[model samples]
Target chain A: AQSVTQPDIHITVSEGASLELRCNYSYGATPYLFWYVQSPGQGLQLLLKYFSGDTLVQGIKGFEAEFKRSQSSFNLRKPSVHWSDAAEYFCAVHLTGATNKLIFGTGTLLAVQP
Target chain B: DVKVTQSSRYLVKRTGEKVFLECVQDMDHENMFWYRQDPGLGLRLIYFSYDVKMKEKGDIPEGYSVSREKKERFSLILESASTNQTSMYLCASSQDSSYNSPLHFGNGTRLTVT
Candidate 1:
């Protein structure tokens, strides 16, 4: 079965501190990994995506994620945390084929402490 | 930028009532999806359409149906709304279901069943 896992249900980081959110996936083929952020009462926004090419992919709002095939992990990281960065982060894998679907993790809620 | 627009922000419907959620995408995307998002359950796929008039069931398709008569419009219908069906419904579109395509989501509809 194909699935995505976000180990951390919630994380708290101080302002200006670095942040890392773990994401792992179980897939059969080459996975297209993605990180998305959802603010309170707002829709989801793409943070970053890794299709192919370089393992490190950059996304909007000063976010970056590294895709590791060996470990089946695509971890999202940021150098500094901001108050505005607090939101629900989701890790997703795009399943290839005619039905192209996204398998999502339970999600990690990030709280930035000022 | 790709724009996926959902018709409602907040909706309140009574139990056993039929509900319709409309979505439109300005980007001529070939793939459109409907998902229900909850607090701990993350996002569950309800239905997806790869092309005009083509529909496929997703992870959770029970009590839900979809319509894609045109290339840019997709609608999700709930045969009979239930309290458990109250959730944040999101609509998304992608250029294709391929690895290169990342989904663009709408503002989401928060539906409440009474």
Candidate 2:
């Protein structure tokens, strides 16, 4: 079975500091990876996605993720964390078969500290 | 911009009561999905519909049913509302089953079954 794992349950980072959220996935074929962020009482928004071309993909709100096939990892990173960046981050893998199903990880909650 | 609208922002129900959660997408998307978001579970898919009057079970479909009578409307039904069914339900839509089309989610409905 395909699965996604986000090791960190909660992380606290000082405002303006660099942030990195780890994500790992288990799948047989070339995985279609995606990162999504959910704010308080709001729906999830797509941060970035990794298809085929580039190893490093840029996304909305000054976020980027690098897909490392060997590591089975797609880690999300931001140069400087803002107070508004505090949210729950989820990593998902698209299952390419008869359906468009996605396997999601246990999200990591980020708390931005001033 | 695609807009996925959930009919309710919050709901409370009694056990064994039948419950209905509504979702509507303005983009006329072909794929609509229902997922439950928990504290550490991230999001677990409950049901999905690829087209009108078509529905499929997802990872966690127990105690849940779906109806997609129209292109823009998808409804999730809880046959017997239980305390364990209290969760944040999210509705999402995508253009197709392609890798390029990402899901657009609604501001979830927080359902609490007493």
Which candidate has the top score in DockQ? 2
Which candidate tops TM-score?
A: 2
Summing lDDT over every window of 10 consecutive residues in candidate 1 chain A, give the lowest-scoring window. Answer: A94-103
**Across residues B15-97, which tens digit of lDDT does each residue of candidate 1 receive?**
99999999999989999999999988899999999999999999999999999999999999999999999999999999987
Give per-model CA RMSD.
1.2, 0.7
Task: Give per-model TM-scores.
Answer: 0.96, 0.99
Q: Show the colliding residue pairs in model 2.
A: none
Report how large a share of the reference interface contacts model 1 reproduces: 0.68
Give all candidates' CA lDDT scores: 0.93, 0.95
lDDT for each residue of candidate 1 in A18-72, tens digit (9 for 90 to 100) = 9999999999988888899999878889898888899999888889999989999
DockQ of each: 0.70, 0.82
For model 2 chain A, where is the 10-residue window of minimal lDDT?
A95-104
Best by lDDT: 2
Measured on C-alpha atoms, candidate 2 has an lDDT of 0.95
